[model samples]
Target: MTNPCDCDIRLIRIDEVIEITGLSRAAVYRMIQKGEFPRQVRLSVRSSAWVLQEVREWAFSRVSPTGLVD
Candidate 1:
């Protein structure tokens, strides 16, 4: 098995998700509460982060079926 240190994982804060998705803080949190979005993993009692690839995949899934990139 590969060493854990060799794994690639991009961890990001909530603010970064807002910047990447252009969604307001309330909207993001609401989606999280509803379990409609990728939830942040708790890193500490007061801190959390999300997987960057999960965010990217979620964004890709939002693509319109009409084949237009928006």
Candidate 2:
């Protein structure tokens, strides 16, 4: 078996998510509520993060080769 470090498992905060996806905070939460975005993980009482790879995949999946939503 391979160690986790060998894989691309990483957690990203909301700010990074916003930067990567170009989605507003409100829009992200809205998509999550609508079952459209990657799910978040509760890290503490009032903080959360998303699986970096998941978000990357979701972002890529939403856009077509021409950079338009498919």
Worst 10 residues of 2 by lDDT: 1-10
Worst 10 residues of 1 by lDDT: 1-10
Who wins the TM-score comparison?
Answer: 2
How high is the CA lDDT of each candidate model? 0.88, 0.93
Task: State how far residue 43 of model 1 sits from its true place (Å).
Answer: 0.4
lDDT value for candidate 1? 0.88
How many angstroms is residue 30 displaced in model 2 relative to the true structure, after the best TM-score fit? 0.4
TM-score, structure 1 vs. true: 0.81
What's model 1's lDDT at 48? Answer: 94
Candidate 1 — which pairs collide?
Answer: none
Off by over 4 Å in 2: 1-6
Please give me the total number of clashing residue pairs in predicted model 1.
0
Clashing pairs in 2: none
Output the number of the lDDT-best candidate.
Answer: 2
lDDT (tens digit, per residue) of candidate 2 on 1-70: 6776787668999999999999999999999999999989999999999999999999899889999897
